[model samples]
Target: MSGRDFTERDIHMALDGELPGEDRAGYEAWLAANPDMQARRTRYAGDAEALRSAFAGVLDEPVPARLTRAALGEKPVVVERRRPRWWLAAAAALLLAVGGAGGYVAASLGGGSHDDSAQDQLAEEAIAAHVVYAAEKRHAVEVPASDLDHMETWLSNRIGMKLVAPNLSDDGFQLVGGRLLPAGGHRAAMLLYEDAEGNRISLFVTTEPAAHGKGIYAQSGEGPRAVYWLDKGYGCAVVGSLPDNRLSEVAKRAYEQLIAGMIS
Candidate 1:
């Protein structure tokens, strides 16, 4: 298949060395000519390395008491007083996998279909939240641009993560405002931006999963295609009624700026 025809799944399989011989050759040829794909591959490889570093040690350790009890179908005698460090390490690995690539292929391979479904649900919910809030007239955001600092601080605290407003003026989109919305079990910050044409795009940010599963880039009842990405430790979804290419362009611009601002 041509590079343009490759699905996110194809890319993931290719990266994980699971593609068949011919498909693997095609992907390699495509990568040879596609710098963006190459960069994505590099990032995916880096995420794999991070995962190995974070959790490879856990494989050698005795299974945690809670895990052993759960595996044995026996209720633990005493409630585990503390969460195991392995869980935290695994979470970190998940964050890197989602943020860098798309999501964890290994997790999905291990029968974490629920996680994949959750990501799709997240995209849908984010789009619905965008449609509901972007139409507001008097109060689109909880804190207006006048209280930018307060808005950022309030959102950061509520989301349990720092927040940075993305600059979209160069692309003719101005920050209208932002508000907190419920997403998956965490509070997500939805920032609205509008262009001169009155077209609105919502940037949904949450710290729950960097990437949960393969995200959908599609047009649906909620609105136009939404481009989602995980950067640092945040899950970012950009939704608008714009065309797919336009939405991708805007998402890429926003992603670069947000990553730069947040990382630096």
Candidate 2:
């Protein structure tokens, strides 16, 4: 098949070794001649690596008998039994990966359950918000970066949490500005950052308490995917319509910068 006819899923499957042998060879050849596709594959590979680093431990840890039974499509007698060691280990792992020590500690102490569906919904909302605002010509942000100090304080106060714009220049994206958005009962801070090509990614943050019952989840739709985690008493959803790998890279960088700012 011609390169023009190949779908993104075909390319992703080929990179993931999920394609049939005959189709794999065709895609490999196509990728070899197509630099853009090759680049996308490289980015996806990096994202896969980052995700494995972040969550593979959870898979290897002996799932609690209850969790294992649930995964096997069996009903557990009691799903609410406390497993402090397992919870602590999971929180510690997440803290190491995201540098949200305070957030993790709060979550652990609160005995709350993390909700996967809620996190997914947050990501979807973030993407919808991106699509709505990225197309704006003059009113993308309520407060532009020109008034950086005021913008930061205004958003922090509005969200009831400190807000800082993560520097994304090393990744070819810079802060454009930000706006305040209402998300359910809590306020959401949407920081808009842009690359040289004018492509934009948004970081959606709110002070909603971490849902402790559900585990971390990664999902993608359209051109963007959301990477979400609970950090320091806040729920963070980093959303972008970029390739999966690029979005993960941006999230990783943003996590590091935001955590550093929070601690320092």
Candidate 3:
């Protein structure tokens, strides 16, 4: 009935509504008395909800034959990336939605589909980051925009590029800040922005060679809609819940500013 009596598993159980009824009151009381623990619980609950809301329909979608074959240890059909390939996005979604089993299948299908898989991962990571951080109130970013120069420099050095937070006031989104994240074996930088209505958008950038793709590609139906592209050795995606046209416009402006900055 006290903090000392509870374990980490208890916190997860409480958050998942799986705790015993007799212990619920004690857990709630303990959480109220521990603000830090309460904050952690809130963040975890938010992340879980975000992931659920983002991929709730993944289970209902029919599995692609290629993925199924790959899962069964058969070589997957190599698909060309002419247009925006949705199946790879779906595969990434499945990997996130189903956990270990999906991971095994993804590992099985990895080597042969390097390029499309890499792009899929970028889209997945971008959307996943947006879903997790955009919903946060207190910890939306690692660095605040007030220290824009410092943030840019720090991210640039970490991500191995001259990272610049694109100006998007014209799109009604002001720079909130940015954060550094791990992207497979590489480093990634993500800048967060929010409009007057408090709607947030995130731009995810990485230096992965495979992330270099043909043109601006749209990834949807997994989480939020994202416009991903590769330019100047940097792969980037602008992710938000905005309409397709609006998201594309913001992404285009961002891409232009980013490219111009690199050139200058």
| Local distance difference test scores for all models | 0.69, 0.68, 0.75
User: Mind sharing the TM-score for model 1?
Assistant: 0.54
- Candidate 2 displacement at residue 195 in angstroms: 0.7
Residue 130 in candidate 1, Cα distance off native in Å: 0.8
Q: Which ranking of candidates, highest TM-score first?
A: 3, 2, 1
Shift in Å, residue 152, candidate 3:
0.5
Best by lDDT: 3
Q: Which candidate do you rate higher for lDDT, 2 or 3?
A: 3
Enumerate residue pairs that collide in model 1. Answer: none
lDDT of 1 by residue, 132-189 (tens): 8888888778888778888888988998877788888888999888899876556799
Tens-place lDDT per residue, model 3, 1-264, is 533466567789987889988888788888788888888899999999999989989999998675676578874343443435566565455444433321222332345434665666677788888989999998999999999999989999999988889999999999999999876556799999999999999999888653445223345444586667654567888898886557767887887788777667
Candidate 2 local lDDT, 131-198, one digit each (tens): 78877869999999888899989998998877778998999998889999866446788988889898
